[model samples]
Target: MSLFAGMAMDEESVKAGKLQIANYKLGENVHLFGGAFYLCYQKGLINWLTDWNPDVLIMEANPRYIATPSAVKWMHARGRKVIGWGLGAPPSNSPHFLQKWGKRQRGVFLSQFDALISYSQRGADEYAALGFPREKIFVAHNSVAPAPTFQVSRPKFHEKPSIIFVGRLQARKRVNWLIRACAEMGSKPRLVIVGDGPEREKLELLANEIYPATEFVGAKHGAELTPYFAEADLFVLPGTGGLAVQEAMAHGLPVIVAKGDGTQDDLVRAGNGWQIPPEDYGALVQVTREALSDASRVGRMGEESLRIVTEEINIEKMVASFVRALNSLRY
Candidate 1:
């Protein structure tokens, strides 16, 4: 399989794996709203498709990409299929008029695809709400990596529960909220903040002042990150973006993820962990304290997290879902 991606925005940076695949870097990204809303149209997309001549084309389901409609048209003209894959429906973060315009444009763009794939069921429902055929929408449950093969075992309890947050330290991540909650906890847990971003300096300042015990480990990944997950008693994401939730679960760590993207609706279920309102500080502290209160309960919850990653969610399952959706389109 081949992929077309652009390396324009800082957020677009990716970790290249060992797998060999045709990866075309196309487009000059134009960042607006400080990289929040940007557009990257692959000017050579049509020529690339003509040369590669794939039977099916899977692409981001975003209206911002001006070349996508043309690509969809080119694929359809050859009796080939195309799939629109993305987080979900058009974001309503803009003004009312712009939101309506964006939604309408997205509806038209998605209507051309043979099938649609969302990262979560909530996303699928959002697509359906936008007048897309619900039956053609599939959920891949966005996965970060494979389930862990090694056993993730921990003592019945630590003298102090180690709470971990693994992701970029950005304002939206709300790592500050996590630090605040950890500081307010009656039984002060060892809060470990992993990953770095523009918000790192400010977050470190806050951590030092209130939660002096908070550990800022900068950024760790792959093998370097495994130990933190293995050693931690609980994983918490106080902000948005849940790609780290499954990773935490794979390591058998129960998660406390604030509901951000709809993806959390499927991953963080009842038995495994708790999902709180994105900005509810009181709920964050309360649920976290509860999760760490009973040692046996935390252990059972961790087991459930492992089970979810093993059976229900993972990169393997996500790929299977994509295959099922794509194969169905072929027939």
Candidate 2:
């Protein structure tokens, strides 16, 4: 099977897997009215498709892209199986027109695919609700490569708790909510922010004024991130994007994530962590205080988080699911 990716995939991923990938050179990344879209152009796509003649073609299902629809129809006409892979359906909070017309258009477009691969079960359900067949939709939980091995010594309840937030500091991320929530925790726990973006300077200013215990670590990757994950007693992302949630869980830290994008539904479970309503600063503060106040529960929850990442959602497991989906198409 061959996969067509709009962005550059890791060399290790291509070498380790049986599936071959063809990367496209992206053109302008148009952003309009708070929505970001990409334009992908592959000059050799048609020739490559003809020469390679892949049994199955898997493409991203982003509505913003123009190529996907045409490519899907082109592949379908040639009797090749096409799979739509992405976070299906826009979030419910999207513009009403998008929810109405956009969803209907997506539903029609997705129904043409032989199968659909969702980032989470919530996404699969959304696709089904939008008229895609339930049986044809597969849940391939989004994940990252396994986190580095680290030993976390459980802290006593009375010990000062360390809370970590890892992601780009952007407006939509609502890092300010986390800063405000941490300040409300009465400076008992140390709050570490481990990423930088447009909101960095402002967030730093807010942290200094409101939460003096907050530490801004700019951005760290690979082994550099190990110490933050290893030392933290709890992980919190009060906004969207929970890829870091899985990474924290893999490092044996329980997460407190906001409900957004439906990706967190698969990763954050009852035993593992809490999922508060989006943008609820009061609830975030209360949850953080309670979780930090009881270290024993946090430790147990951390163990559940570790178990879920190791057993259910990791890079290996995700790739295996993709392989299975591709294999199913052949038979």
Q: Could you list the CA RMSD of all candidates, in the order they appear?
A: 2.6, 4.8
Each model's C-alpha lDDT? 0.85, 0.78
How badly does each model clash, as a count of residue pairs? 0, 0
lDDT of 2 by residue, 1-331 (tens): 3433433333212222233454433333233343344444544456557666776788777666656667777798888898889886855566898678767787777777888899988889889999888878888888877633555555543257788999877777788998888777764688899997778999988988988779998888767898888778899999876568888898888999999878888889889999999868888889888887777888899988988888888888788878878877887
Give candidate 1's TM-score: 0.90
* Candidate 2, residue 88: lDDT: 68
Which number leads on lDDT?
A: 1
lDDT of 1 by residue, 1-331 (tens): 6666655556533444544656654544444443556666666778778878898999988877878889999998999999999888737798999889978877887788889999989889888988888878889988888866877877877778999999888888899999999988888999999898888999989988999999999888778988888779999998887577888888888899988768888888889899999978899989998988988988888899999988888889899989988988967
| Candidate 1 lDDT (Cα, 0 to 1) | 0.85
Give the C-alpha miss distance for residue 126 in model 1, angstroms: 2.1
lDDT of 2: 0.78
Candidate 2, pairs of clashing residues: none
For model 1 the local lDDT of residue 299 reads: 87
